[model samples]
Target chain A: MTPRKTDFPLDQCRCHLETGPIVLVGSQWQTERNLMVMGWHMMLGFTPAHFGCLITAANHSHRLVRESRECTINIPTLELADAVVGVGNSDGDALDKFDAFGLTPASGKIVSAPLVEECYASFECRLVDDSQIDRHELFIWEIVKAHVDTSIDLPRTLHYRGHGRFMVAGDEIDRSADFRVQNL
Target chain B: MTPRKTDFPLDQCRCHLETGPIVLVGSQWQTERNLMVMGWHMMLGFTPAHFGCLITAANHSHRLVRESRECTINIPTLELADAVVGVGNSDGDALDKFDAFGLTPASGKIVSAPLVEECYASFECRLVDDSQIDRHELFIWEIVKAHVDTSIDLPRTLHYRGHGRFMVAGDEIDRSADFRVQNL
Candidate 1:
């Protein structure tokens, strides 16, 4: 077998860790509202709709989300990559991310957290379970409200590739027709 | 405001559901073993890593995972898109998915579950928390061992976009130089 076929142990290079979409998370607590870039998150449920995000204690949004128990998940397209990085670069406690990055924050219907207007889609989320927060720094949230820009069907989004690199969503392929089981 | 600028309600769309990487889940219990394509998963922690995946009760792998308390998460690149769709089309209850799909399953280090050799990376996981299984059909797993194909770096991965369409990962953009805060 060739070297590429051999099973190699992934000791310290956790490059595969960057497998999710790069998102801008919005949080609000009392008078403090902030936006921070997040890439480690996933959908947990379908019927009641659950979302999970990992926020280390050091991030400013972690405290804000804990106090408010609500937040908004904003999905931005490739066009807003720079802004995504900008929001992630600044500490929310240090500056108002909205004013610093020139991002327009719109009020969410269900959550007090602000949603980025330029993003293609937004989900207003409420903290469902924080049992693992103290131990894992993971927050489980339920999406109560959803909004999208229907005019643009599929806007390209950004995916983080560790160490400052990102991959853009591109060229969709549809293989649904080949499946034997119609519904999944 | 332009039509695209208007934030319309995504009542049924739920487009934000596609926020994470598409992974192939490997499950085995007794004589029953299966490979099912899954897109709903997230990273929960960094040290002593925790991973969460939502598997509906209807899927065959759900029962196997519960009985075995172990599974493997295989990350496939875009080169295996057709195989991904093929694995998702059939019912694992009827046949051995490994032979049916012509997939190679190698022994895992810490778990009984077998890893897909064709995948770029594989995680041997053991179920850690099942409290949310009955209520949310969610499984929280801790990765015991990790494997990656070191020969290939940054291979294009497939991201599900719901309704049969999939987005391909493309082009790397580095913004580390732009960030004022050096560490995140």
Candidate 2:
């Protein structure tokens, strides 16, 4: 295939960077609690449930996460798209994000960070590595506890596609029969 | 909402762990070259283009990456789903994966690893951090070079769901007009 040269536009080129589900990151530090919409988080491992998320130092939740070393990852469906956008648009440092966004924060079983009651699932994580924070702004954590909304039948999650673009999880295709490897 | 009790089956419960787009990782170590399907990778940063991909110690490519400290992340569209599945189904250690999967390995510009010519985009990465390898098997790298197929329009990438289940990226909805934050 003949390839053509493309301009590396920061805003558009970064779209490929977003592949994981967009989530609301809840963080608490001292008397302050905040929720920031994040699309740069991913599951890092299987057995121990390692999770990694990138939060730039400029974000308010980033400081809170660094101070408290704990956070809750809330998975919201398409119904909360507007709220997700609202949470992301505003600065957590400037106001009471929970009150402004009308988000219900419930206490987690393990972590002190509040989980969004509106979300269908929440993962309580504790910081496991911060060595790469200054360089890559990545916070590695282990999911100590998890909760899911059993009432939801099919959860439609949002995937970020740059420049205010989003894609909803679509139809499922089973290809298990095609694979020769049993467990990977 | 009343919640129902559910069992946490490692294999079943972990299905939700997969949220990112699946890519075929191309690696070269010594005289051996291989391709492996991976869904557990994430973009760590933009400038300098830091990336992290979780490769279980068990995967054949894991050793190769550790030795070579370089690899190419090949992004294939939905058209190559069967080949992606085929590459992941067999062991690369025992055979030449390129010929087995009919993948055209073009010489990479920066890394010794060959790029999949059929892929629309490929990133040449050099390992930056292996600190979490023993614990989480996460390899952190910086994308030194990138190539994209500018001619390809509307690239529909596949997202792995669980146990042979996949989700194709659907319609795109733009929400950039609503956001006030300039750069995230």
Candidate 3:
């Protein structure tokens, strides 16, 4: 690998950190359960705990999201990297992704939306507001509960680029110098 | 540093990417051109051209953005990372971040927003739509052009995890075992 590829480490890069698509599993209109890929997702905090995500107005997930007013944000394990694009490029409007991908869903204790069985961590949220932007919607919510699979405490991770490509997060680096570089 | 400290990447594991602020530096609202640090942000795609991002409602840049109807999504560099936090934390309601951060603004060709002086790359976007989500309004944009500092093709990047934390993007890894990964 070249120097750039060799130095590719997820822990060291800040931009790649919070920019991956995880499975957003939730029930649509309360009864229909759905899962869509969201690279626009991120956690707002740890204390009160919050997560924010952007959804397009044209997408089916947005419709489902609006009716239920609840959802689950799952952090994908390294192994789920390929699955991320697989699910994201495809749409809930056309296919039954759960059955197509052989993915499983389970109900969560914290929120009404179902969680992806394969994901490592799940955040159950109650809608904070329904804000609009041109064609996309921003759903800010308060995290009610966080679920983790102790088995996959540490999994390989993936960050989204744009289209269908994803960069798997690898390696960890150390900061020997402080903000001033000479401070260390 | 402990191994665990270097374990999960700040980019991938930092929960604060959602809350960080950014200044959308544009030509000028009255005297100048376009730009705005949209706190209302999110990612929309992965390839063909990897795309995703958010646009906030309350900033003055939003108006320039409406006039130009396009802006670049600049992932902050390490040096301006704090500016990201400062911009996000401070409201367009109170003060102008561009002046505060000392970031230079340059006019964009196809779009309206100006280029942030210290940013790594600017994804020039065209307005996809400006729809309201529910309460907080958002603008959906599709990036049409990308301007990068040719010297550095954006190897590392920055992310806002809400509040004051920012994470730079890490390296890219091809974890796909085979080309068929997409087909699966």
Candidate 4:
């Protein structure tokens, strides 16, 4: 089911990404478009909403994102498990993942890359640094805009554990009382 | 109780870390030793067992790791939740985290940095690239040796969310049958 999403605050992006769930990265350059499942990513900074992820040059989406200098980071829930697995296993070059996986593509506010409408959240990102691309295939991006389905209080996100295994985002433990105000 | 750990295969380190659990980073240089809770880390390579993490220079352990060029990435379970929060909230430079939190500091086989005996796993690491450190405060390290408690088939790891909240690692979904052999 496609979710009705609202604009999200850029600084609060860490709240959603820091936990590290497997994301479907959407990319497009002129006529070519693709989606790749990525797990190796981390929040770099909060103010500029910097995010870093490794996308090897071997992937079909690599060149598209490199040329476009933009992409969409979409957070899929447990319901999209099959699509996530399918996207990761198949090559994006030969397949139209959006059509094959039955996912809806929505136009982004800032980036040309399409966002997956079925996802719980989608962040439109622009590449901020390309220096590490040649050496590490790491793309540093600044999230320009974010859209989130805030209705889903606790989205059951998928976290990849390699070898075709995954761990679902589970019960929340609120330890706010234990934390220092400054730390929080 | 501290579980007895055996040497783990370096190539399969992704199985444990790719899931993106918050880890306790251990570092020591001369008389100064510190522990910092780190969530911004990712696997870079398998053969050389490369791992990349961001440690801003403001962190006390950052200087220790930078000077010594070594650190230990320790994976703690839900059992050590308080210790994890304590280490993160308090200043590492002023306090002995291991002693204060009642975590045993075991000597590493390869690196001078001590490993937390209470953790489910500990990987001794050596700094591989310092080029990004000055520019991004990103440290690239190669896992020299890894130790894991194989007895625990499933570890309840803590994934940090902002505002002192956490998501405990949950149920496993094994879709190995659905996966392509090469992709798996």
Q: Which candidate should be chosen as best, given lDDT against the real structure?
A: 4
* TM-score of every candidate relative to the true structure: 0.85, 0.85, 0.57, 0.99
Cα-based lDDT at residue B37, candidate 2 = 91
Q: List, in the given order, the native-contact fraction of each candidate.
A: 0.57, 0.60, 0.13, 0.84
Rank candidates by DockQ, best first: 4, 2, 1, 3
CAPRI rating of model 4: high
Best of the candidates, TM-score: 4
Query: How big a share of the true inter-chain contacts is recovered in candidate 4?
Result: 0.84
* Higher-scoring candidate on TM-score, 2 or 3: 2
Q: What digit string (tens of lDDT, one per residue) describes model 4 on residues A34-133?
A: 9999998988888899999999999999999999999999999899999999898898889899999888889998899999999999999999999999
Which of candidates 1 and 4 is the stronger one according to TM-score?
4
TM-score of 1: 0.85
Per-residue lDDT tens digits of candidate 1, residues B1-184?
1011112122211122223568889999997889999877776654556778889999999999999999998877777887788888888888877787767888887888888878766778899999878866779888777766545545567887665667777776777798665542
- Candidate 1 lDDT over residue span A1-184, tens digit each: 0011111122211112223677889999999999999877876665466778888899999999998999988777777877888888778888999999888888787789998887766778899999878866889888777776555554577877655667777677787788664553
lDDT per residue for candidate 4 within B1-184, as digits (tens), equals 8979999999999889988899999999999999999998888888898899999989999999999999999999999999999999899878899999999999999899999999999999999999989877899999999999989877899998889999998988998899999888
Better of 1 and 3 by DockQ: 1
For each candidate, what's the DockQ?
0.28, 0.29, 0.13, 0.86
The C-alpha stretches of model 1 lying farther than 4 A from their native spots are: A1-19, A180-184, B1-19, B179-184
Residue A44, candidate 1: Cα error in Å is 2.2
| Each prediction's number of clashing residue pairs | 0, 2, 75, 0
Pitting candidate 3 against candidate 4, the one with the higher lDDT is 4
Winner of 3 and 4 under TM-score? 4
